[model samples]
Target: MSRLATLIDEGNRPVVTAEFPSIDGGGLAAVEKAADELRPFVDAVNATDNPAAHAHASNTSIAIAMSQFGLEPIMQVVCRDKNRIAMQADIIGASLFGIQNIACLTGDDVTAGDEPEARRVFDLDSTQLVKVASGLAEGHYLSGRAIKQPPALFVGAVENPFAPPLDYRVMRALKKAEAGARFLQLQIGYYPERLENFVAGCVEHGVTRTTALIPTVVLTKSAKALSFMDESVPGISIPAEMIARVAGAGDKDAIAEESYQLTLELSRHALSLPGVSGIHLTDFRHDGSLERLVRDLRIGPAFAPDPVASASGTTSV
Candidate 1:
């Protein structure tokens, strides 16, 4: 079986997805470094376009990560970055490079990514993208043309469980399911009860079969990040106390350690839960903090080997 298939077993194990930070041209290198740093614990890498500040997520750098790193890349194909034609081509191209997982997103607005002049093409939204991927998986292209080998991809979609109108969140997951979404990766929710209630609500809504539900952990101490997040990313809440704790830290290194420690706590908490499938690590500022958390946190036998040749690498992120 392929590595991704093995990572996503429906029964007992949980997978870990490491987020590729949007740190400009240096971001891909960071991802490469992280992949090498956390080889054993990271099952896949979630590639997100920093629609607010990144000009690089939609190009060859993504392809380079897929081909060179041997990392199972989750192509976060956001609609805001491409039209129908571009999205379709990207799906096909990623498939050719053995990228078997995709997360369909309508994408944050250009303003969110801080690129107001950037043209936003959310022409299809996420449901349509899922349908497009499903069609491609079934041996037919979106144009209905038969391809030589239809790429078989495991489609994943996002859900914001903490949104005010909870019904809409349920409906969104259902829509993605109808569009052939195999898994749902939820946006980070601050309260654990809120997270639990969100998943329980999904089960009650008759979408329980839509498995492989992954909860993400966002680690950062930057007040600027919190401000940007509050304005741009909906349903994400950062408490004042948390911010103050990070603010009191002496330096970036100290802040990253604090964030890493928090992430480890969150990871352990999530893994102990029954219905939770996995944890997605989203450390925005810290370079190697995610890797350090995975290393310090004890995992079961299912985790892959450590990516760092030895523990000699810096853990300060």
Candidate 2:
């Protein structure tokens, strides 16, 4: 099993995961630099696929690079760019380089990217992709053809508990878990009541028993970032009051400080939840806020190692 899998199974401490900032340049050196920043604070990091419909490094290559650099990567595969065959190939190919974690997502529409003329491919949605990834891990293709040796993949998917049709979010989570998602990285949300109900529903329906629920919290430096997300980001919704709180906090430095505090509060609330197994961080600030937040919460592989079982052969995230 992967280190992340081992930690999730043991349920001893919170598993910390993060997004490896999309690499657009600097070759392998860029990947290394970003990995160094995140590796210490996270158990595993995601190599996102055409995030927000914009393209950069391929998910497979970034994931493979992260693995070589000693940072375990959750290879993110999106349905918006490739056909089912290509997606399977990316997952299988990354596994050849020791990439074990796969996070399936239904990417944003092509219209959301700079190159709006790009073709949009929705060969399969998120849940179907999860089932397909499970098939690959189990030693077969979707055609049911067998593999000589299947790669061990810790499969997972993303969820938006704060989105509309709120009551159905829990059911969606259960569906993903049943489809073989070992974990679910929730979208960044500001509403604690929604998160509370979402976690509770997961436990009630038995989603949390087998799968890890990792909620996402972003680290941003200003209120403009929050406003941008609230107005433009598709799935993320920030209450007007949250934006006002930071905006009304006075000058630039104070606004930034307030933003950090808001994030810290969210992190603490997430950690205190019972069925919650981990946290996913989306970093928007290069300042010391990331380190400070992790240090303050005292949750992550950098803070401590798992004492229950050392099967991971590495420190816990």
Question: Against the true structure, whose TM-score is highest?
Answer: 2
Instruction: Give me the runs in candidate 1 sitting further than 4 Å from their true place.
Output: 23-31, 57-60, 222-228, 231-234, 241-261, 285-288, 300-317
Tens-digit per-residue lDDT, 178-288, candidate 2: 999999999999999999999999999999988999999999989999999998888889999999999999999999999999999998998888899999999999887
Single out the weakest 10-residue window by summed lDDT for candidate 1.
300-309
Sliding window of 10 residues with minimal summed lDDT for model 2: 304-313
lDDT of each: 0.69, 0.92
lDDT of candidate model 2 versus the reference:
0.92
Candidate 2: list runs displaced more than 4 Å: 305-317
TM-score against native, each model: 0.81, 0.96
Clashes of each: 10, 2
Can you write out model 1's per-residue Cα lDDT over 1-317, one digit (the tens) per residue? 33555656634356777666553556657657756654555777777655444576563356447447776677788888778888888888877777778888777677765567877778898989989987888888788888877777888788877767765777777778778887788887665666777777666665557556788887675655655666557567766666566656668767656655666676677666656677787777556566566656544233433335234455644
CA lDDT, candidate 1, residue 73: 74
TM-score, prediction 1: 0.81
